[model samples]
Every structure is written in structure tokens, then in C-alpha cells.
Target: MASSNFNRWLRPEVYPLFAATGVAVGICGMQLIRNITGNPEVRVTKENRAAGILENFAEGEKYRENPVRKFVRGKSSEIMPNINNFFSKPEL
Candidate 1:
């Protein structure tokens, strides 16, 4: 009777928790292996510092005038242009 109770608790269909945990652990292990061998890029150094800065600047400038940002800027200016100006100024 005690063995029957243990069998009922250990039924395979009722133990998906262990399966799910094993799947999650397997995925993490695969990702760790991929990251360890995936990247072969050379490291950045002084010679490329100016090029790196320019690349970052251009990337940022590309997003500066995006439509969503422009719309938000327009709405903010319409709603509170004076407040924007007040904040934009240098204080004495």
C-alpha cells in the first residue's frame, strides 16, 4: 500500500516539472557553448579609436531624426515650448 502511494506520486505524466527544468538547463548549456565559440572579431585599440567614435556618432545621428522622435519633439514643443526654452538656457 505504501509502494502504491509512492507510484502514484512518481507517475511520469505528473512529473513534467523535471522535464521542463531539464529543457531549460539544456538550452542554457547550448547557449553557453555557442557564445564561447561564436565571436571571432578582433579587439579594438588606439589606432581605430577615431573611427569607432565616428561610427558611433553616425549611428546615433541616424536615429536622431527618426519619425517617432520627431513627432514626440513636435508634440512636446507644441505643449511646452517655453518650458523647453527655460531648460535649454545656461543659468547665471
Candidate 2:
């Protein structure tokens, strides 16, 4: 009985339909969650704003000039030579 049940589950026709239905259900569930959480509009709005030619340029420039950014930039410059050395070596 167990072997027959396993054989039925291993049938190609049955498994394909089952997998398709499962994928459809997962997609539908994701859409449902996005709708309930308002994530779709938030992502669309962020993309639209970013697509503007000069909308956030000043804000981004200010962020780059901040003190924390200066510290990170200094550290990155120091580390870059070591990183380049690692990547420039030939394989053993």
C-alpha cells in the first residue's frame, strides 16, 4: 500500500500540476500581503522619486559630505590598496 502511494505521488502528470498550483498560490499570497501592507505603493513612490533628474541630488551630496561619510571615506582609501593587492595576484 505504501509503495503504491509513493508510485502515485511520483507520477509526472500529477506532480507538475501540483507544483504549478503551489507556485500560483505562493504568488497570490505575496500579492495579498503586499496589498495589505501598502508595500507596493511605497516601492513605486521611491522608484519614481529616484527617477527624477535632480530631485534628491542636493540631499545625496549633503549626505556624502557629512562627518561620518568623511570617516568612512578615509578608512576605505586606506583599505583599497590591500584589496587591490589581493585581487592582482595570479592563481597558485
Candidate 3:
């Protein structure tokens, strides 16, 4: 009985209202999650703006000098190199 009444109340004429309410609820839910996760919404500020620009310029310089080195560092490679050395062959 309750389900039938709910279906009757959700007529096609009220779809726009349902859609708007759904969008508002979704936006509020995302804001709640972002607050809980502590993610910064704004990246730029007066304190670090100049430092950020200088770092970007320095990175461009390094990229021009040695692209391969820059790629490795950018990927944060952490694999260790091999350590075994080969010995000289004995006379036959």
C-alpha cells in the first residue's frame, strides 16, 4: 500500500523538482566527503605563488638538459642496481 501511494505521488509533472533535489543532494554529499578527506580545493596562494613559479622554471631547465634523468625522477624510480661482478676466466 505504501509503495503504491509513493508511485502515485511521484508523477511525471514532479520530475524537474526531483532532478533539482538530487543535484543539490549530490553536491552537498561531495562537499562532505571532501571535508572529511582534507583535500585542498585552492592550490594557489600569495605565500607560495612565486616559489611555485620558480620551481616550474627550474624543472623546465632540468628537462631541457637531460630528459631521461628527468623522466626517471618524475616517475620516482626506486629499483636497486645489480651488484654481482664477473671474475676473469682461467687458462685452458
Candidate 4:
């Protein structure tokens, strides 16, 4: 019974329908996330810009930031000084 059920779902005839549904869901999810992240109405950057009706926090700040930017903004003193020295050219 279980094997029959599995075979019913795994039938080759349903591959195109499954593929289409998966792609549509994937696209919708991606667009939703993209709109959430990239929407300027929810972002606040300038002092004069009016705040969004639903915005309650620093959306722009979070949107513009990532791990690499956070690492670079930190005091170099907190990181290994030797790593900086390796990249910085010495003056003649």
C-alpha cells in the first residue's frame, strides 16, 4: 500500500506539473524577499525623509549592513595588527 502510494506520487507523468509548481513557488518567495529587502518606502536614510507608516526600526541601517561591512568598521586594534600590516605598503 505504501509502495503504491509512493509510486502514485512519483509518477513520471506528474514531473512537469511538479517542476512548474516548484519554480513558481521559488520565484514568488524570491520576489517577496527581494521586495522586503529592497523597498525604499520601508527604508529611512536621510534626516528629512518622512518615516514609513509601518516602519518602527532602523530598516535602512540593517539593509545596508552585512558581516564584511561590520568587520571593516570595527577598530583595527580589535583585529590582528599583523593582518593589516600584510596588506598596507610601507613608505619609502
Show the colliding residue pairs in model 4: none
Stronger candidate by lDDT (2 vs 3): 2
Q: How high is the CA lDDT of each candidate model?
A: 0.63, 0.67, 0.60, 0.72
Model 3, C-alpha of 52: deviation from truth (Å): 29
Those runs of model 4 whose alpha carbons end farther than 4 Å from true positions after fitting are: 43-92
Q: Which 10 consecutive residues of model 4 have the lowest summed lDDT?
A: 43-52
lDDT of 4 by residue, 15-87 (tens): 9999999999999998688666675464446552554365534765665675567877856753668767867
Per-residue accuracy of model 1 over 1-92 as CA lDDT, tens digit each? 99999988788887798789899999999767644443222224557544542435554565455666776773654567788778988588
Each prediction's TM-score versus the true structure: 0.31, 0.34, 0.37, 0.44
Give the per-residue Cα lDDT of candidate 4 at 40: 48
RMSD of 4: 11.5
Residue 19 lDDT in candidate 4? 100
- Which 10 consecutive positions of candidate 2 have the poorest summed lDDT? 35-44
Identify the superior model by TM-score, candidate 3 or candidate 4: 4
- 2 or 3, greater by TM-score: 3
Q: Candidate 1 has what TM-score?
A: 0.31
Q: Rank the candidates by lDDT, best first.
A: 4, 2, 1, 3
Model 2, 1-92: lDDT tens digits are: 99999997888879878999999999999768755454323334666657646545665565447565676774646447777877897568
What lDDT would candidate 2 get against the real structure? 0.67
Candidate 1 vs 2: which has more lDDT: 2
Overlapping backbone residue pairs in candidate 3 total: 0
Candidate 1 Cα lDDT to native: 0.63
